[model samples]
Target chain A: MHMDFSFSYYIGLAGIMVFAISGAIAALEHKEHHHDVFSVFFTGFITAIGGGTLRDITLGNYPVSWVKDENILWAIFLGFLLVIFFPKLLTKLRNELFLFDTLGIGIYTVLGTRIALDHGVNFFASALLGMISAIFGGVIRDTLMNEVPFIFRKEIYATACLAGAILYLILNSFSTNGNMNLVVSASVVVLIRIVAVRYNLGLPKIKIF
Target chain B: MHMDFSFSYYIGLAGIMVFAISGAIAALEHKEHHHDVFSVFFTGFITAIGGGTLRDITLGNYPVSWVKDENILWAIFLGFLLVIFFPKLLTKLRNELFLFDTLGIGIYTVLGTRIALDHGVNFFASALLGMISAIFGGVIRDTLMNEVPFIFRKEIYATACLAGAILYLILNSFSTNGNMNLVVSASVVVLIRIVAVRYNLGLPKIKIF
Candidate 1:
């Protein structure tokens, strides 16, 4: 599959940047111990690329994404540098972080579903993969931070990704314009996630004895 | 690659079972909340297959092992059932659990290294993959349980796997007897792990302010 230098591609890069920033912020918030600069940088790098790495691996995509694209590595490295030099900038840019993170969820969800479809995986599985790509990085970051994943608690995060993936599949079936489908589906995910967070909407928690 | 239903295959199955049991025990030992049977089962399944899944994905090996083999699924399922029915049995079988877990580390290390070699990865990379396959499941299990990974903290777990992988590569180079190579490498890992636990030998903790 040929990927053009499209708007979605730029959005994906922005997503990577924000994810790395969030990861760095998480590391800083970790009150257990003082992590060295390398540990902080490693955590950010992993959080930025972990989900896509898993997606490519599951799909048997060769060379993986970051391995093929040095730019992504450079982007993450820049994020690490930003965190090290300006640790308080993250808090100051909280709203911007939220915007970029939500956009990232939408863009990653569409990208993951499209890749899986290209591999000829079934629709249901493709959507699942899409959700995994969008959320698993945060899952990994939270896991490494030794905390219960936020998605499992008080967020409609993965649910929004699932919604967007399903919407993308449905739209793709009718539309021949790939960019249109990408924009519509990603917008739906971003809107849903933003609205969910705005109104404090989330799935009911389950408790079993 | 043609896989014979050989002794190593049986050892791999046994490894999956023990890994699953350890995951269940971890879920039970979680102090924060009560996990239901499904939670216990999910944790066990992830712990049993997580490392191999990651390994196969990284290698771009399609139809990952668990996806191809129904028997492995059944083995893990049996482990889950055993845990659910006999929650107290783990405490009673601590010594047995330790024995099987050690054996698992040995077998998984060799299996991972052999698969990487089959893919034509260089020795160092193959050894790294071998260590990942041997220890990553427990890392996932521990992370999910909200603890610092045992391998990262106070254990010689990954060291044992690394040593075993190097031994396997050296043995394979010197001798063409595959079974003999497998036995010697796996024995080294198991012996190292057992001795480490018995004598409380571990890497020194690092602290950076």
Candidate 2:
């Protein structure tokens, strides 16, 4: 039990650092496109929390996350500077960044679902919100980068979040313990993501033909 | 007084219609890109309310506009179908659509600013939220279309919103009558948009050369 707690703790901290660094690197990489530093920071920060903000707005949740927390602001600023000054330091951790990403997807999916359900959004909309909460940031980021959003390309990313949300809703209806639902549902998302990556899985494309 | 009320009333109704029809027309215009009807509907609807929804979320305003109003949802559906069945009807109205757009920008900008102020967001952010409320829908739509958001261009659209928001703030601090502030502030946005378009004015581009 203790080991599990510490494992998640490290994942949380390390994941944030990796996420921030990668975002910074992404900003730096696009210098030729003429993004001023402020623009870079804007894209990176939105990529980090845009999904949550979108969810909160749709659900009418107040103050949003970063608005109520100064740490998030400072962390973004620090992440931006960290990448600029120590670009060499990121090479070793590039592979492990998905740990942070997976954790984020899991937490955000369940959290957004819960919030939507609380606000009396229909179960269908709640599930969609969960998926939106997990992926919309990437949607916005990709859009800003002038590319088709990757999730629309038959990737398993949104599908995983959607599945996790459905599972959470099902477990909740059965009157499962709240914490049990949280752990199991989130863990399922994490498992699916890791397994998909390990085995090279993707959703089959549609056939309009 | 009656004349003023009726003008705004017509602007309100016509603006929503024009906004929806133009959005639908935009969807039809992109048929070769292979957007399914559902995708077209999603993009068109989001462009119509995405900005206001963004504002409500940032300010913690509850139950956003569309959720509380079934008319908004019905209007989007009707708009979608209108263009598909009646393509020839929109040509004469194309040039006049800007009237609806300008009214929308003016109303959304000042309305967003007032809400943010009520939520105790800092003045700087309030000004920004006002601009976001005015233009972020287009930003999202453009992002989804994989193009640079037109607002990010040196076009004067966002500039007008930003200016109107600041003007509202200045008036609001003097404890101006709320209705008076609403009228004068929104009019300023409308005036700026009209003048900029009339003269083909644009912000000067930076020269790193």
Candidate 3:
């Protein structure tokens, strides 16, 4: 039980870092001269926390994740501090946002699947919940930014999370050890996202005419 | 039964029109000399449909408000057309936006309260949901424009919805007739909003240190 809780904690932290970075990058892109460091930091925090918060609220889990653990708050704070102190330097670095975002996505998907499975949800529902936990924050952030949701536009985002969630379920049937499952499931999400980005694989857009 | 459905329908239409006009006026206020028509139109549509759509989704109603009724769609379309065709004229008539938006706040709150009541939710939960339904869309629009959510800032927005919803429950206990009850509830919301805005009444902000 201790192992499971800590594993989820670490994975969730990593996910927050990634989502925050992505949000920061997006805010930077949106405003050329408006160096609103506070806005960027707030956006990052929202992006990281938004999806899981939605999942928990919908599932009737109160007190929320960041509220429960001070570590996640520190992570967001440090991330914001890092960006603020080194805005141009961090923004200039190539692929850092992508790297962290991919890692966060994978880790979050595994954590979500684990939580749903622990709650005794069915496989399909678990997978869907996992994907929701992973992608909904980005969707919320993008929508609030007046842009089409990132999941609806680019990258293999939702699909990547769903695939990883399904893979976690498959891995769990073969073994019940908690740590191995976390590693394996997170690896599945990470690998899929990496390959998808490399090969430029994504879902075909639904063309409304 | 027919009167109940028709009353809900008209209430929803009024909400949509008001929300759209509010968005258009907001866009006009955003820039003094330059008007971005597309942004205005997009914001208008989002404002019009946003609150009710969120309400339906969170309440687990599928296909959402606009999708469920074609008349709602037509209302949105007509609202959009009016704003798109007459941006300057619409901007000049800004008082109409407040009247319409307050009316929308009332109608949507009642509609949301009704849906929750129909679903057998508790009074407090129903009232809270009603407020969320009425205010969330405008919160969203403000956030997308990179501003603080309006409800969280200067307005007694959510409070108006909650007050109206409370009145709804109180009236329901006194009367069993649904149509009359709904009309009374909606009127209560509109009046509350108008009075609050006119008197500059709002919730006290909490200072966290």
Candidate 4:
């Protein structure tokens, strides 16, 4: 198994960094809960890596990526530090954070789909894993914070990831260049999420009483 | 790999059924969320099997138990149907439910510890896995329902499981009869939990702002 250390890997790292920041930002919403710094740090770190950890575990990928790569831990630590020192800075950079968060989802969706496919899962299962990888971190974060998962609420978040994964499978079938598939699929996820949020488009909520 | 198809296995299956019922009972609290039947079913199913799935994945135990044994799925399905048809029945049998829930936790704790130890992890790690297996189903259920985890609250739940796991390790060192070890350890967990709840014993809550 020849591992490629290339541009795409860097993008994935950047995605991890952004996801960590988002996790920290989400943790700030629970200030009234009186969470300690370690609590905040753990939430951010888990939020950043939870999805990927589940993905790896399900695919039988041992020594999960974060366990193998200490850089991810460093990135999460940096996120925790930034949140601790400049808590107000996150509120100021909301727009930028949103953009980075969208990008992170896109990058993770493509990466997750590719990894699941590599593990010999069917395309449908791979797409499901891709979406789970993209959104579960936030789900875990919100759950810990005692809030309904934002994706499960009236949001187009997971749908975008699902669409991107399907697009990736389609692209992979047509093209042999892995880089092109990654770029195109990730872009699709980012675009869909951005457009949906901008236009306030959302899935219809089901109410069963 | 000699698998035992005996009383312990039947107890495990019963544990799964009770856990699924507990999950459905929890979901009933989310009536205001207006979740559909599918949502309720998925919640019940995940809560019953989530911990074991995580344990199997971490131990590289392929074809997860529920995935291999369709009986577990049927049990979860039965739980869902019961919840849907007789929502009030759960509330009526609260004491019975509590007893079954405690028993389920004990059974899962022993099963998880044994599996982790079988995978060559250290005793400490195995014990940790044991506690996680006992409590994580409820954690996942609470998270999905958008509430703070009951285990993390002022509850002696996970602590009881941890103590039982330690006792299991100690007994396993001295005894060669696996059945005796299982029964003793699981009984310890059930007794501790019942005593704790009856006496209103709990851990002190930490408030860190």
Model 2 Cα lDDT, one tens digit per residue, B42-107: 777888778878777687676776686566677667777766676676565656667778887887
Whole-model lDDT values for every prediction:
0.83, 0.70, 0.72, 0.79
I-RMSD for candidate 3: 10.7
What's the TM-score of each model vs. the native? 0.63, 0.58, 0.57, 0.62
Which residue pairs overlap in candidate 3's backbone? none
Cα lDDT tens digits, model 1, A1-209, are 35557888878888998889888879888997367887788888899999998888887876788898888888888888888887778678889889999999999999999998898777666786788788888889988887866654445777889889999999999988988998999999999989989998765432322
Q: Lowest summed lDDT over 10 consecutive residues: which window, candidate 1 chain A?
A: A200-209
- Fnat of candidate 1, please? 0.19
Model 3, position A174: C-alpha lDDT score = 90
State how far residue B164 of model 1 sits from its true place (Å). Answer: 4.7
Show model 2 residue runs off by greater than 4 Å.
A1-32, A67-72, A121-124, A205-208, B1-53, B56-114, B122-128, B134-146, B150-209
lDDT of 3 at A86: 66
Model 4 Cα shift for residue B120 (angstroms): 5.1
Of candidates 4 and 3, the better by DockQ = 4
Instruction: State the number of backbone clashes in model 4.
Output: 0
Top candidate on DockQ is: 4
lDDT of 2 by residue, A44-150 (tens): 66676678778887776767755554445556667666655555555555555577688878877887788888888888899999889878877776667676777
Q: Determine which window of 10 residues in candidate 2 chain B has minimal summed lDDT.
A: B1-10
**Model 1: CA > 4 A from native:** A4-47, A57-103, A120-129, A140-209, B1-7, B10-14, B17-21, B24-28, B31-46, B53-100, B119-129, B140-148, B152-177, B180-209
lDDT: worst 10-residue window of model 4 chain A = A200-209
Candidate 4, residues A62-121, lDDT tens digits: the string is 678899888889878887887888878877988887887888889889889988778767
